[model samples]
Target: MIKSQVGRRYSKAIFDIAEEKNQVKEIYEMLNSAMVLYRTDKEFKNFIRNPLIENEQKKAVLTEIFGKDSSENLNILLYILDKGRINCIKYIVAEYLKIYYRKNRILDVKATFTKELSEEQRTKLINKLSQKTGKEINLEVKVDKSILGGGIIKIGDKIIDGSIRRELDNWKKS
Candidate 1:
């Protein structure tokens, strides 16, 4: 909980700087890339979380990985490391993206279906969701065979379940 609070503060600071320099989009992409790397690369994740490794070494590795990116964003990475808040990088990035999406009036929606959705289906779903939510939709689709058929859509704390399994359960209850 405390870590998240700290992350929020750091993200807000970075967002403010990015917003001022008109580089919010670039910085967001950088942070998102970093977060993806951190999540997908076990060795890199362990390396960053290792306390035995010196801050300089971590900073060097970070520079090598994202050096070509914005200097301001790089400085923020260094600043967080210097402050011993490196462990909270994931939360910081997540919070930063939340701010970015909110600023742009984009709603992040997760949808699960029994099978893959084609381009037309995805577009129709996104358009329908956008209209329902009154915000631009950033859809993340996943396949869940357990759903049996149909799909489920989640936005924030609310979930709309349209799966055949759910329908069967409702029928049983009735």
Candidate 2:
């Protein structure tokens, strides 16, 4: 909880700077790319999280990795590293994206089904969710075989489970 609070503070600072410079979208993309790398690249993640790594070395490495695509605001990486908060980068990025999506009046909804959804199905779901939430929906669809059938939709704190497995369990209880 403390770490998340700290991450939120840092994310808010970065979000403010991005907003001031009218680069919120760009910064969000950059942070998202960094988060993806942090999650998928074991070597890179270790390099960043290693306590033995000097801050200067980490800064140099970040510059080398992201220098071509990133802007001056990438210096935030150096600041985070210097402050020994490099481990919180993922949380910071997540917070930053939450703020960005809210500012854009977009809600990211995750939908899990037993199989892949067709394009038509996806569009219909997105439209329905947008109408219900009064916000543009960014849908992320995942296949969860455990759901057995039907689908489950999650929008922020609300979850709607319509899976057949859930229905069967409730029926059994009754």
Candidate 3:
């Protein structure tokens, strides 16, 4: 099977268990924390990916990292290690987060403007987006002076390009 398929399958299994136990948020937090470590800590990432390290050793290390009480998170880690699919941990976390966010009605959005938004502008934008999408918005803001003015909002696959650069381009075309 493909690597991503492995990720999807394992994530789905873990997510199903989390949903049944009403611990979806907790599991997501634990797994996401692990992913963050795997992403940012070079030593930890290498240790987990090293084939010479025994699975038992890896399990113990992961258990230590994730805490003994995090059974759901530890079980997923052990299972993945036992199956020698540790390389797909990143994809598993990514897929699991997709499931968790969808289940929780959360939307990840990115907004870019020429300058920083004032507190009122930020609040109003979030409120309007939440009302329009009916999902709690997780907004990430960026500043790009080249946009000149106005802003651009990106929600999932859709891009709302209201930047002044876009407007100027349209005028030039006309």
lDDT, candidate 2, 91-166, per-residue tens: 8998988888888899999999999999999999999888988999999999999989999999889999999999
* lDDT for each residue of candidate 3 in 49-151, tens digit (9 for 90 to 100): 8988887888889888787446765786678778987778788888888877888899999999999989999999999999999999999999999999999
Please say which candidate is ahead in TM-score: 1 or 2. Answer: 2
Relative to the true structure, candidate 1 reaches a TM of 0.88
The digit string of per-residue lDDT tens for model 1 on 75-162 reads 8777887998877878999899899899889999999999999999999999998888899999999999998999999999999999
Among these predictions, the greatest lDDT belongs to 1
Q: How high is each candidate's TM-score?
A: 0.88, 0.89, 0.89
Question: Which regions of candidate 2 deviate over 4 angstroms?
Answer: none
What do the candidate models score in CA lDDT, each in turn?
0.90, 0.86, 0.87
Q: What is the lDDT of residue 69 in candidate 3?
A: 49
The residue pairs in collision within model 2 are none
Query: Which of candidates 1 and 3 is the stronger one according to TM-score?
Result: 3
- Shift in Å, residue 43, candidate 1: 3.8
